[model samples]
Target: MEHAKPLLNYIRKHVTLSEEEEVFLCSKIDYRKYLKGQYILQQGDISTTQCFILSGCTKMFFVDNDGQEHIVMFSIEDWWTSDLGSFVSQTPSDFNVQCLEASEVIQFPYETIESLFEGIPKLERFFRKIIEQAFVASQKRIIQNFSLSAKERYQLFHSKYPQIEQRIPQYMLASYLGFTKEFLSKVKKELLKP
Candidate 1:
């Protein structure tokens, strides 16, 4: 219940919810604690739930044919994480969602979400807005990857997610920026200079 407060507040930012509605919403949520390095969702598994981070961080990534891991996104406290394609289609996920730290999350099953949307129409709008934001962010990331230099990408990442930079390892940050660890180190050195 206490963990639900952050999620409730986040939803309230998009729509007003009565006390009864809030209680109903919270009742459907399931809580889980994940140890560091645990996988919440793995490649090839159907993603049946969307998760809200109550505390700690997670990385969503995929392994390539050459067996290199590509970091797609990082979700931290108060953020939502899911493989949207798999979640909506009930298909196997290509991405793996793994805990970067011992973490707590509140999960909503896809079936429960559908029931909520039908019973509480306003929630449909809330989720729509959340998806819209996610889409815009994804588009921005794509554009940045194609148009921005590695140094520029690193700078933008640092500016946008300073807290995450402190929490995650430099190699993960480098991967997210589509740069080698050596390149990221060079960028950091340049950034430190006057």
Candidate 2:
């Protein structure tokens, strides 16, 4: 019950849910915990659930043929993290979602989500709004990757997500910012200089 508060609050931000609806929704959710370095979803597996982070952090990324990791996104408390494509299409995921810390998440299985939409009509709109926001953020990130210099990107990312920047390792942050660790060190040094 306590674990559901964050998700309920998040839902209420976009739409109102009556107590009954909230109870129905919670009935379908599964609260799960993962150890640091454990995978929530791995490449080649179909995503059957959508997760809402209750506590801790996760990284979503893919490994290229050359075995280089390209981070797609990071999620922390009150954030949703999942392979939306795979969950929707019932296909293999190209990405892996792994815990960066021991994490607690609320999982709504695909079937449960389908039922929730039917049981709680407002849920569809709430989900749509969140997905739309995520999509817009993703598109902006794509544009930034092409147009922003590495240093500029790093600065923007750091300013926006200082907590995440502090929590993650230098190499992971460097990879997310699309630069080498050495280059990141150089960038930080340049920033420190007048």
Candidate 3:
């Protein structure tokens, strides 16, 4: 009930849902809890459900041939997390979605979502907009990686996700910033300097 507002806000940003429609949407979702390090979606597995963060954080990452994990995206409250490329296209996932902390989420399976959308065409538009936003975010991250220096990237990350540094490990943050731990520490110190 209390979680309804953020979910409603998230949906209404794309489409207005009547009370009946909101209730129908809520009925399609179920609350889920996950422990830190739990995998919501693993590479090579197909994700069948979409997760909305009611609280806590999750990261979607990929392991390179050298066995290094590169962070692709992070999801926190009001954000949606799903391997849409796999979930919608029915292909194996290239990345893993892992809970970064003990977390609570609202999970909606594909079938339920489809049913809800059939009754509410606007819901389809809402989810489409979410995918569009995710694509834009991915493009921005790609542009940053191609053009920004490691220190500048770290600064941009800090400005983008102030909570992630507090919640995630230094090594993981280093990986996300495309630097070694020592280098990231040096950069961090420089960032803190006057």
Candidate 4:
């Protein structure tokens, strides 16, 4: 299916765009598909594209000094994926973006987004708002990390993205929640008990 409507509506909700402008913005993006486990980006690569997840799931994570994976974010259907700092600064990415399931996404080059901002000033405002929301969510996640217990963190995550929680894998969820697999299983059992 053409995810055009959902994508267009996502944009329209943030800023009004003429038919011509919508099509113009859409024209620059390349729609592509990836199998589960495919890597959209890897460490040390200068990422030049920002992806809009149209279907399935994707995750962004980094391997630390000890080579343990720490998930930064999970992008489900309709979410955007990219290492923002790297993409904006044209620097090598520290994280890896991997498809967690067969996925379809719209990939737009950084320059295209820059040009879109120039042509549609409202887009700049829309993205600024997006960045603000991202920042707020990041702060909330950090607070939750320190203040909430593992079970509470899992519950809060469910509250925020029940649908996403259902769709992704438990290990990935465990990684995101900063819990061991067995601990997450215990948490799930607690949640499942009547």
lDDT of 2 by residue, 1-194 (tens): 78899999989888999999999999999999999999999999999999999999999999999999999899999999999999999999999999999999999999888899999999999999989999999999999999999889999998999999988999999999898999999999999998
lDDT of 1: 0.93
Q: How high is each candidate's TM-score?
A: 0.98, 0.99, 0.92, 0.93
Between prediction 3 and prediction 4, the one with superior TM-score is 4
Ranking by lDDT: 2, 1, 4, 3
**Which candidate tops TM-score?**
2
- lDDT of candidate 3 at residue 187, scale 0 to 100: 94
Model 3 stretches astray by more than 4 angstroms:
1-5
Q: Which candidate number has the best lDDT?
A: 2
Tens-digit per-residue lDDT, 1-194, candidate 4 = 26566677787888898888887778777788999999999988988998888898999999999989999899988788988899999999999999989999888798788888888788889889878988898899999999999999999988989988888888889999998889999998998999
- For candidate 3, list the clashing residue pairs, or say none: none
Colliding residue pairs in candidate 4: none
Tell me the alpha-carbon RMSD of every candidate.
0.8, 0.6, 1.6, 1.7
Shift of residue 115 alpha carbon in model 3, Å = 1.7
The candidate 2 region of ten consecutive residues with least summed lDDT is 107-116
